[model samples]
Target: SIFASGTNLDVVELWFPRLSDEDQMLAVARFNQITSVQGSAMAVALPGIVETLGTLHARSYRLGVATNDSTSGAEKTLVTLGVAQLFDAAYGYDAVANPKPAPDTIQAFCDLTGLKPTQVAMIGDNRHDLEMARAGGCGLAVGVLSGTGTRESLAGIADVILDSVVDLPDFLSARVKETI
Candidate 1:
């Protein structure tokens, strides 16, 4: 994913190591311009995302989003999808010391919500999300196949894997039952 490159430092240091610092800044600025402008148009809520998130919200789940997107871009996209109100908080790359594959965002989620890592279930569609969850010591790290990641890619990282976000409610219900 384009966002995997993260900030200017990430882009220069990881993606284009040979780029001059000045060039890296220019690249980052251009990338941000394109992404921010196209962000809303690119916001495609997958099938069942709204319904599933709505159901969870109705059940009083405290939902949040931690993404590599810019905060304004994430908010705009979520609002465009008509699901922004469902989330209690939304953190993006700039909000934390580090982005995904590090624990900063997840830790920010915990801090913002007054919840412990053990009380959180991190559900994502990619390896970075799962890795972030793991790094944060979340209780559950779940992977969904609806996005870029394959089961093979998420194997051994996610505690449980689901076909899509729509399955989450049932999966949570089953987990509750198991505990009882």
Candidate 2:
């Protein structure tokens, strides 16, 4: 939805324009370079992601993804992963004036969900996510080892570093109980 904005879409198009008619046929092949990595693309949901999302959904927790990816790219990845339905809201790079390092994206998510920043937890794999969570005043910033980020890389930024998204359910389960 936000991707319709001219400023943002222009930037995205500049970086990754639509493939030519001929190249369109090679889209999958080209995409495979990044997505086919052992743990690179979001299309291959990490271990424990489904169960974690299921638990969160079952508990009626509001789930959202605030990412620096374009809306179309985000939707494509989610659909490919078969988990598009799990998120209550999805904000893309074009959703706000500022991206990751800025709190705008996360703030937009909070605004859309009618949730305060303090009620949200940001689960990501990068320094930018941690900075955004902090800037947005999120309840917690959880970093996972599924991506390029390492424990040391996330050292001071994250509130907690998890082995993988799979461990998220247990963490949230405990947190929910504690809050109650």
Candidate 3:
């Protein structure tokens, strides 16, 4: 089951592999245009997400999003979730010279916050996110089950596997020492 994951560029690359590079670029452009037009309406905020983000924000955690989506797309999703104000920043794949599995997004985050890689925690529901965390030497590699990854797939890769991001604050408070 090759579900849609990664940046729009990556997904579009997968979708149009045999096309000429220019055609692929055009395809990505069209895809992004369609997504910008329809993404917010298609978004579904996971239960407890708003509360979780609010809790983290209120607790003064400098939170940011490092998504594979385009920055605008990620912002739109957050807006749809009613939690756009909770984040300090949101970095899309385009925000970096390299995308996930490359450490670039994590590097961007570290640079923005003046935090060392080891002081940061990386959480996502896919392999690329965990891989990026490891490559960036992050303090934790957390995998959630609410998205594209299965327990079996994330096993032995992520430092800790949780059911969803809703469980993050408590786990981080209690288990910061365990990491990849």
Candidate 4:
């Protein structure tokens, strides 16, 4: 549930409810340090992710990241995965006043890409991501099963539910044909 509703800071508050405000913040800092050490150790890219991103790029589709993680953290992971060059933009929670479940991240992407909200597709693995897409009036809200979301969580919100990002190219092709 942390993935859906809270950040690492929220974890400190949730787990140590008895802690005073000052102590909770201290706990958060320690928690962040622990996770930061673990983060780089677990930065592996999903299978075919690089290829999938390359496929999108070759088609001149804009690509980027919108994550609950910090922008610099996302960028570091991308660089570690050797896919840093594939993305056109990367926005994280801190980049916007309101994070997921709000329109901020999607709007940021659209603004930078010169895209109308209706021209954008928001692909993610959580209900918050889909909610944000809807709030921003995105053309498509795609949910993938690879991370925190489940079928029940995403069903009413997503325009499509994919097994994972590897399926994106085929899904995109199908959508293109439908329009044609």
Best lDDT goes to which candidate? 1
In terms of lDDT, the poorest run of 10 residues in model 3 is: 1-10
Please provide, for model 1 over 30-135, each residue's C-alpha lDDT reduced to its tens digit, 9 standing for 90 to 100. Answer: 7666665697778888988899999999988889988887666777788989999999888877678888879998888888889999899999989999999999
lDDT of 3 at 121: 85
* Alpha carbon lDDT of each predicted model: 0.84, 0.72, 0.83, 0.83
Candidate 3 structure quality by residue, lDDT tens digits, 152-173: 8888789999999999989977
Single out the weakest 10-residue window by summed lDDT for candidate 4: 32-41
* Clash count list over all predictions: 0, 0, 0, 0
Whole-structure CA lDDT of model 4: 0.83
Clashing pairs in 4: none
Lowest lDDT block of 10, candidate 1: 3-12
| Model 4 ranges off by over 4 Å | 16-37
TM-scores, all candidates, are: 0.88, 0.75, 0.88, 0.87
CA displacement after TM-score superposition, residue 68 of candidate 2 (Å): 1.7
